[model samples]
Target: MSAPGLLRTERARLTALYGSLLLLAGGGLVALVYVLVGQGLYASVSGVVRTVSPAYRLPVPGETVDVGRSPEPARTMAPGETPTPEELKGYAFTQDLSDAVTDATRHRLLMYSLLALAVFAVLSIWLAWWMAGRVLRPVGVITETARRLSGENLHQRISLDAPPGELKELADTFDAMLGRMEHLVSAQRRFAANAAHELRTPLAVQRAAAEIGLAGEPSPQKVARIRERLIGVADSSEHLVESLLLLAVSQEGLEPGSTGPVDLAALAAAELAADPPHALTVVRTLAPLTVTGDRALLGHLVRNLLTNAVRHNRAGGRIVVETSSDGELAVSNTGPVIGPADVPRLLEPFRRRAERQHTAGEGAGLGLSIVAAIARAHGASLAAEANAEPEGGLTVRVRFPLPDGQGAVRGAPGSKIG
Candidate 1:
């Protein structure tokens, strides 16, 4: 059977179980009452029979005695001829009526007990079914709502109206999960559209360069220029595709047992050294720091931060990279002043602040986003703040959890520059 059929069967079983239990208890009570009343009535009747022995006598075996009737013909006896007490004890006509009364009472009691039990059994079953339905009504509603849910109708919620209980908690949790799913889905759709747009721009450039430059057989100089343009566009497209792939992988998170302790300071120093600080004054306050994560991804994260700082900086600007033993790394650079509100958009894929200068080697704007994804994969926190310098720059900080769950040591890293 399907899930709903199984649930209905379970509900029916619960109803039957509860109803049977109640009916059995009631039947037991009725039976107990019947037995007790019969026993008490028998005892009382025996006592009365013993008390009135002289007035009433039971018939002997094999004696056909008529109750409440004299065996002899009705006749007036003389004073001397009156029956003695001893003779009356053996009187055949004086039959005991207590036995008959007790028997009749027991029969009536059994009949009433059976009748009441039958009536209450039916009543109890109905009550059980009603109670079961009341209790499982929330479950049914949740099932139906879940069944109707899809990507199209994920906006709908199981806003169950019930008192605080397990069922209500379950419903609330489900609603919370649905909300997260909807957000994730919307974000994914946006990411896809943005990526397509980013990819299309380069392709369009290559196509235009080809059509305009190579319409007919041209000079060697023109072909060389067109070649350079196509190569540049192809290179940028390749970089964007790689960035997208890396972002996707980082979101999936690192594989288990594929991580180790990496020195954050060492990684930062290496990235800065590898990339020339062209027309930039670089300052580093590197301290010994270690964190557990994927080393390659960590290296990429460091490289991205440095690249972002360099790309966004003005000519002859200063760049400061800092790392501490407490597992915090920060990169700050001098650039056009950015607003605090605009800082968050930089962490989104393909989002760039309008005030920033776009240089020839400008990135696909996924540097900070990839960094954020890698940080999340390593169970770290990332935050960006606009620097207070009049020549404006931005500072990005990342904090990773200690390997042994030690307390974090917080301290200011870089000094203000003129």
Candidate 2:
């Protein structure tokens, strides 16, 4: 059979293994004890028997007694007659009789010991099998629950009732993993629904613009307006498609040999200089921090952060871009007040505030989500929180692991401008 089949069939292998070990130990102990007790008891009993009868006496160990070789038969003691020492010496224990008793007693002892050991071994094996089953009961539950689960039934959990140990911990961890999978699956469903709606809206708009504007030899003015509208719709669709593809790539993870030392401070500074928000006051605290990751993705991360801040900000508001020597980057902007609870939803694809749902000229709602995906791909942590109300905005932070053999570097002085 295959290895997995062998393992399944021998689920009680631990029981048999331990039982065999105990049996071997018990056998060794039985042999040692039998030898000691048998030798000592036989010697003492034979000595006593020799004393009981004056006609016989204990002989030296291993000596053979030959009755036919005796000079004469044993003689009985007469009343009121004293036996000579020579007579007593002649009746000294015979080897044949001693050997006979020794063999019989040894055989009986061996027989009893073996029988008892056999019975104990059988009991031990049964007990071991029971204990093993009890110990592995949680595993059985986990397996059954897993077999019953799929993408459709991810709600099921293995609530194992085993004692607190490795098995219980494993079950709990498995349940936690299922919970995460369920959450991700639900989010994916929502994302698909939202993506379909978003993609469909522009197509519907373009179709209407074409059907109405191109009918019956339209005027140049109507043609230009319709053509412009079509181009804008097409551009929006292209942007949405591009964003989706980038998100996929980021989540798919950085390719091998695509990672190298990247100066995060320099990258952020370049993004800020490239597209300085005209209406917002920009402040920069660029530090010299080096990290390892895909530089293109890193650039996209910085650009998205800046664009998110600019798009979702009040006119003439402040935008603070900061980088630290400790491989950290943070961006904060002044915008509409956001609740603490709603801040986490911003990292999800196509998630937007109700107020922004009707806002125009705002790019597809994937900037922060793409940032999150890229951060995850680089093994960096990203967190966003609502700034205190009154002067409301959001602060998003990303922490990256430093490149190998690199140490913290001092940050440059803060610079403020638009």
Candidate 3:
């Protein structure tokens, strides 16, 4: 439905709710007043009857009574004396008058109460509707802001200026959310632009090589060289595609069914052993460490870390890989000294240090980004710090919490070699 129609429906619902609550409260108050007024009037009439009843002089049987004087006391009368017919009639009339007065007063009170209730009910509904509209005015502003927001106008905010209460709080929170959304959208746009640029380079190279090879009368040697170059381009493209896919998967998060006990220590050892760094000395301090996560993703994380360390290392440098039973995995390597300021940007996709940018086909700069994503998916903490040594490098540590029913096992303390 349209926005206006939805807003009207919401307002109507709120008005109805307010009106219902007011009606219930007003009805109870009117009922209470009706009861109290009726009781008070009845009591007043009864008091009048009690006070006036004693003044009436009724004649007694076989007794001579003065017509204008006060009636004789009952105790002074003889035991056999009985009330005359006139006295009985008079007593009945007085009782009837008292009852009539009480009934008349009660009827008048009931009529007034009903009239008051009818008038107040109408007024209550109108008042409730007005109050509801006032209360919902801020909501209307919020709705308008949301309606106007899009990718092109994500920077817009409600910025409502109202009293310090729930409405103000809601507006502030909404503005904060919009700010965050704007940041993420901007970041995503940059990432897409960079990725497109990166992908196009390899394609352009391949196209140029193919076109040149097919040109008039290419020698066999030339053809062989072109084929090798094309293969290198294809390899680079494949690596970029794989890295992008892995980054996407890491961002998408792990499914519940894919989670199980994973041995991080074993995965680290396996990765190091499979691709031994020839030029760099490798140190292993792996111990038995288990965590709950997707095994494949964990292995990918380990491999990425190992690859980054090897790819970025200097000749004859050392790489240290360590795992603790307490669910800690760390990798450090010797390379060109890295600045502390560049540590954070290294985890962002498509971001790389200037030194590594010229290393052809070595990486797509998503190695640590994928590792960070995978660590987030597994509820683990990943931290990177520039080495404190005069010779620069990076130390990346990933700490995973043990799964339920698994206790942490303390082993020898790991060291940070400068």
Q: Please provide, for model 1 over 187-299, each residue's C-alpha lDDT reduced to its tens digit, 9 standing for 90 to 100.
A: 77878888888888888888898898898898999999999888988888899899999999999999999899999998887787777788899999998889999999999
Question: Whole-model lDDT for model 3 versus the true structure?
Answer: 0.81
Compute each candidate's TM-score over C-alphas: 0.78, 0.83, 0.79
lDDT, candidate 1, residue 325? 74
Off by over 4 Å in 1: 1-8, 35-39, 44-100, 279-283, 314-318, 333-345, 355-359, 384-394, 405-418
Query: Model 3 compared with the native: what TM-score?
Result: 0.79
Q: Model 2, 280-376: lDDT tens per residue?
A: 8888898888899999999999999889888888978989998887778889888889887788788899988543452357777889999999989
lDDT of all predictions: 0.81, 0.80, 0.81
Top model number, TM-score: 2
Arrange candidates by lDDT, descending.
1, 3, 2
What's the alpha carbon RMSD for model 2?
6.4
Superposition TM-score, candidate 1 onto the true structure: 0.78
The order of the candidates by TM-score, greatest first, is 2, 3, 1
